[model samples]
Target: MANIMLTKDQWDALQRHLLPNPFKVEEAAFLFVKVTESGDFECVDSWCMQPHDFDYQSAFHISLRDETKAAVIKRAHDTGTALVEAHSHLGKWPAEFSRSDLCGFDSFVPHVRWRLKGKPYAAIVLTTADYDGFAWIGDATDPVRIDGLVIGDVDRLGPTGLTPLTWGPWEDFDGHI
Candidate 1:
């Protein structure tokens, strides 16, 4: 997977925007982060969706309004940037895309890519403690898995600290299949 670099500020901004109620598990949260062109690999702006803006919501599910989705696409188009659509997993459990999350991605991700001039698009499931991410780098049937995440200041590990013999269940799980 392509590496995504976030400055200390960008990482902090997303953390705050995504988890308004970090301890609440009643509904999933969602946001879209626009980042620089893949080659530059930097985060730029983020748009957080409020709970009341969703059409569907629950501890394990979420659906944004059609308008919100359109807005995200427009922002990417206007800025010539890639977009990372991230959501919450609600607790201490490791975060990975769920079955329904994958299903929903299959339906909309391709379209979002097409509108963004084929720029890379990513999905992230974030929890209070950690997150797992996946990206569609170039139209593959499945996404390229993000092996590790590095956020400046917030999460810092040397190269060896990042790589390992095996990733946990989230890395091994693919509910879509």
Candidate 2:
């Protein structure tokens, strides 16, 4: 797996869309970014998941309409881009990937890959400050963790070769920015 690059604007937009109601119950969002996978993964543009894509979803889980899923797969196949399925984890900074998440992807991710003619499929879970994500580069049930998310010059590293990063004690409010 390789690092995923997001332009600052794209990154901020995603964060805003996903984190708006963080104080409340969990909400999920999706992004289908234009990806280039030469040496690494690069997302140059993105499409945010819309309101209609979700139905009576919950704070703990998200489900896409079958049509929405089919459309995204078709688009990815026609346009030739990787698909990223992202949602939020409302309660923690360094959120853990729930067993529920795994069960959901065991089938969903592979189907998306098949539809896209083997284009990469990724599942990402974000928190207020960080995220955990993995990618299925091949047709395996397991995934290789993403390497990192590059924002400008810094690397928000992920669990690629090593274990996921742990958050240290934090201050609820940052007086000094």
Give the number of the best model, judged by lDDT: 2
Candidate 1 deviant stretches above 4 angstroms? 25-40, 153-177
Tens digits of per-residue lDDT, candidate 2, 67-113, equal 87787777767667777777776775475566556656766877777
lDDT accuracy of residue 95 in candidate 1: 62
lDDT of each: 0.64, 0.66
Give candidate 2 misplaced runs (Cα > 4 Å). 22-25, 33-39, 159-177
TM-score per candidate, in order? 0.75, 0.79
TM accuracy, model 2: 0.79
Best by the TM-score measure: 2
C-alpha RMSD by candidate, in order: 5.7, 8.8
Q: In candidate 1, which residue pairs clash? A: none
Model 1 global lDDT (CA atoms, 0 to 1): 0.64
Error of 2 at 88 (Å): 0.4
